[model samples]
Target: MTKPKISIVIPTYNRADLIAESLESILGQTFDSWECIIIDDNSNDNTIEIVTPFLKDKRFKFTTKPLGYAKGANASRNYGLELSQGKYIYWLDSDDIIHPLTFELCINEFSWNIIDFCRFQRTVFFDNFDVKCFDNYNIDENVFFIDKSHIEKIINNELPINTCSVIWKKKSLGFEKFSNELLYAEEWEYYSRLVSNGLKGININKVLIYARKHSCSQTHEFNCNNYIRVEAKKEAALLIVKNLAAKKMLTYSLKRYFICLSIGFKEYNLFEQIISTIQISSVEKIKWQIFYTILPLRLSLYKIKKAIKM
Candidate 1:
């Protein structure tokens, strides 16, 4: 059997209705050297039926799991990693569709040097396909390209990469778990580890991925009953820092030290100065600045008012 060049992992829960569109986009790829590995994540709905027709293709196969009930993308991705035979790995959300050229373009820029992951920007698709670029429309003079070192800086502390926006090298994708044993921040949790390992990537600025905003998407579509997800995002960040510092894998500076404190507060941890020493020192990243400085103040005011009413 001929080994496939790329393994596209699509994890589905109950996205039976939308999986068809994503599969169609994959089928339409200009590059024909790829295979699609779809993980059902044990959906109770008709997602299996939606995908069954596609399995007729020789390159397409399916796997099912019970742990991925909500079937977060990470879980499906890990399952795919275990099952993939291709040298390159691409993850597509069951509900989102890609531009026909995405895989082709990504493969062209592919590098396995741990120093590069192929990257392109995404245009969020709302009710229609309205495009928004990072530089907006001014392509000639306004652009930002960072090397592996610079890219690693952003992932060092905050989530700079959107999981669905790029295909990752499976070798560099080591992480603790899919759901982080918490709510939000699953992507950040994995991304931080990848960054710390000195993984590299390419940024193609062109809009290749289309993020679908609809009624059931996890990040925003699902109803946010409480702030559990956001709180999880906050705590996972602290966990990332704690794990890094404890292992001596990171270093921090004074300002970053303070910023870590602020994130700790945001995570509902102690706001004391004692937490300040927990910082792992590093040089400044072009001197960080807070754009919306009033956010914390405004949040405090609202929380105080809510407290009084309660």
Candidate 2:
């Protein structure tokens, strides 16, 4: 059998009802030289039964997460990376839909040998399939080069680059792996590493994927627990700051770290550790110290504002 040019790695858990649509979208792709690797993370649902019909096509491969492996999307993705034999890697979630021309359009950009990755926009859909909104991160540029400012924007959460909307050359990824320990914000950390390491890529300025926002989504679940989500964001922020420092962006890193510390103020011990460990101007430090002292009042005011809005 001929080797596929692109490997679409999809990590799923108990997505039996939604995965069929994702698989069918892949089957409908305009590009033919691609393989779909569905890594099941020990899903007890009939995910296998739903995907079985698609296996008739040799390009659609499914594997269960090995025993003792971490149980999460990141671990499943890492496993899929190990088993992938394609030249390029695209990460797709089991509940998302890819446009029929996504692979064709992105792969065309690789004609330039210097390109290491490509990213496109995505349209987010609500649970009822209503169009919630579109991510217009790079919608203006035909092919925008990623620079320090762009990296900073991404690290600061000012940009929207989801896993499904990006594709990377397998060789450019080297030994990098997503953080399996993080239940949230793993993508932010992983992408920060990629950008800091000078992984050159372009944004296609087109929507090529449909990201579904549902009650059962991981982000939604994480958001329901503010403390857990904030802690995870802090961890991701720490990693990004460390990477930025390595790249000689100390001031920016400190500012980002400060923001993270502010957000996770409820986690006093962790917040204090981060404040002490990260370097900042003495005046800035004093300001944060004052802010920390008034953190409770700030939180109360924030709650009041939110309650008023509601």
Index of the highest-TM-score prediction: 2
* Predicted candidate 1 versus true structure: per-residue lDDT over 1-310, tens digit per residue: 5898888888788888788878888887888888899888677889888888898898889888555344466667777777888877787887777777787877876743533467667667775543232225332322344343553355554326666776776665655345525556666666555655566676676777778887666667214634666566556666666656655654445235445445435435433332443552333222332312454676789999999999
Candidate 1: C-alpha RMSD after superposition:
7.1
TM-score for each model: 0.73, 0.86
**Model 2 Cα shift for residue 247 (angstroms):** 3.4
**What are the lDDT scores of the predictions, listed in order?**
0.64, 0.80
Off by over 4 Å in 2: 128-141, 226-228, 253-261, 268-270, 280-284, 291-310
Check candidate 2 and list the clashing pairs: none
Residue 240 alpha-carbon offset, candidate 1, angstroms: 2.7
